[model samples]
Target: MNSRYVGYLFCGLAMIGVGSTVVVSKAIAAGLPPFSATALRFAIAFPVFIVVMRVRRVRWPRLSRRDAWLAIAQAGAGSVGYTVFLISGMKLASAADAGVIAGTLPAVSAAVAMLALGERPAPALIGAIALATTGVLACTIHFDQLSSSRGAGAFTGNALVFAAVVCEALFILLNRKLSRPVDALPLSALMSGIGLAVAIVPACFERPWTLPFDANALLGVVYYALVPTVAGFVLWYAGAARVSGAEAGLMTALVPVSAVALAALVLHEPVTSSQLAGVACVLAAVWLATFGRRLRAPSTAG
Candidate 1:
């Protein structure tokens, strides 16, 4: 298979990893504080990455001082912010709602790429963004329950999740710029390590160690470390390296769709008709954004 095809395949697999993260994270949050869970996830994943690098004989890139700092900053915003806010959002909102909100991440990433990297989005891409945004709103906002019992916490949680999406978008843009000379594994390891360090201090202060200990909690931590933190990122970087920022952004729309489906199946969340429709809209939008150019063609002259 071609490298680009391989990259796309990796990205699709990464979205599966990203989708499953909500279920795993919700499980972890049941017995662990958000920050503590975040810390443990990265802390365990970092060493595994180091061992993998050693086994593969992958040498770390000699990053310049500026690139190193940029990587650290991106790690702070992306890994730290994303993990913390994601868990917090799940605490305050339904997993279904969190999934819906996360659907907007592709739009956020596209906007960040445009602003930070001057990569202009096509008109079809704009339409895709609109369709995806509509889908998110439909999934998140319960028309029947809007005036009945929707509280401030739900809205606040959604906002936090959106903030996490924006931070992730910025991270993607920064990664593209910094990844040119950097090896993906070492750069990922360094960034994750830095994020782990930042998260650990705050988690310690919050007394994550004192939280109830159980086999499930231990498994949750390990799952996050190995699946989402390590394997998910590897697939993500592989895809991002081969695709344009906009194309990469469009692919992330799958995360929320997959998450919602998984939540319905695994968590017993109700897959309401409206939510299913929203999922369809989001999926259609992603397809349009990704392949609209091919769909539209000019007549050839004989």
Candidate 2:
């Protein structure tokens, strides 16, 4: 079995883990204030993270002064900023919209990889990103209906989600830089700690921090803490190590598809013509991004 395929598998599962959070977060958002909801989930996850690291004998890295600040920034952007923007976006936008917006992460990550990491995208990747970008625009700029609340405020919500995506992209690049030698579990624990530092103060204002007893909400917190926060980070970087950042970016395109599917089934959000068109374009883009190179050359192992 190819390690690249293994990487894709880990990334795909991580994608699903991250994607499905939209519906869960939406449900949780109804019961808890956005900041509280974000804070509560990590509060549970971070302590468990410490336990897991200790149990697994994953020691923290002794980083240089520069790397220490880098880790803090990474945690701030990826964990704290990403969560704040995303949860707030979900509160304002439909889960379906948030799902569709998430598709942009791959394109954003690719661009970030190219500019920051000095990795140039091949022509096929460029084309695929164009298609995905068009799809995202289609989803966001709905010509048919602009009178409704969601439509009127869509920009604010979607923009925030897009900002979250950028933060996540930065996290991906930083993780690629940092985790070449550092283990994912310890790195995640450190990142989560910094995230808690950022979340705690804001969360304090929203406190009493009472989580809901509703099965869905409880499940949201538990799954978020375990699946996405703990396991998703582990699996994502584990896979990322075996593949290119471009490939990893391409892989996260699955986020919106899964998120939209779950949003429809769980949130009962309407599926509009724009959403249909956007999804079609996004799927096509993903197909191209993932396999377009193979049309020109023999597929190589990552």
Candidate 3:
């Protein structure tokens, strides 16, 4: 198999893990304080990363001061900032709204890549972005649900969710900026440690010790740590290392598609016709973005 195809697979799976977080995080958000939950999630995953590294005999690579700071910033934006904002946002916004707004990630990531990484996208990729954005809006947005009745809180929640999207976009672009690229495992472990450090302080104010524990919430947090936080980070970095920033950005279109599907499965939300249609569109977009180049290339004469 082509390495690029493998990169796409890893990225797609990573987005699925990311999408699962929406349902999981929303479930736990009310029961767990956002900052504390973020802290605990990273804390749980950090040790697991260490164990895996030790088992694999993967030693931590030496980093320059710049790379060290870059790692910290990545943790701040993607690991800590994204989780805090997302959990906090879900407190006010409906999961559907979050999923709808999260649909912006592909565009946000592409724009950020263009601006920050100087990535000039191919025309096919641009079309894929359009298709993806439309698909997410189709899947998640209900025109009937949009009204003045939604209130200021909804707006604030949407804003916070968008903030998470931007942080994630930055996180994607920053990976491309690493002067000396670290392997996926070591980088993920480094990120988990930094995230724990950054989030634990804010978590203190939440008075985590005093909060009553909910078993379901605890389980959600544990799942988040192991799957989304640990596995998602590793898969995303591995894929991002193999692909262009723009391509990685485009892969984020899968996030909301995964979110909507998981919501139906886990929350038992009914799947709507519009949602099914949206899924089809997103799949087409993925196909176009990943294979359009080959399709456009002229075939050799027999």
Best by lDDT: 3
| TM values, all candidates | 0.85, 0.82, 0.80
Root-mean-square deviation of candidate 2: 4.4
Better of 1 and 2 by TM-score: 1
lDDT of 3 at 148: 54
The 10-residue segment of model 2 with minimum total lDDT is 207-216
Output the better candidate (1/3) by lDDT: 3
Say which candidate scores most in TM-score.
1
RMSD of 3: 4.5
lDDT of 3 by residue, 8-38 (tens): 9998899888888888888778789998999
* Candidate 2 TM-score, C-alpha based: 0.82
Q: Residue by residue across 195-283, what tens digits does model 1's lDDT show?
A: 89889888988896676676776797798789877888788988888877657756777787778878988889887776777777777
For candidate 1, which ten residues in a row score worst on lDDT?
143-152
Q: How many backbone clashes does candidate 2 have?
A: 0
Sum up the clashes in candidate 1: 0
* Ranking of all predicted structures according to TM-score, beginning with the best and ending with the worst: 1, 2, 3
TM-score: model 1 vs. ground truth = 0.85
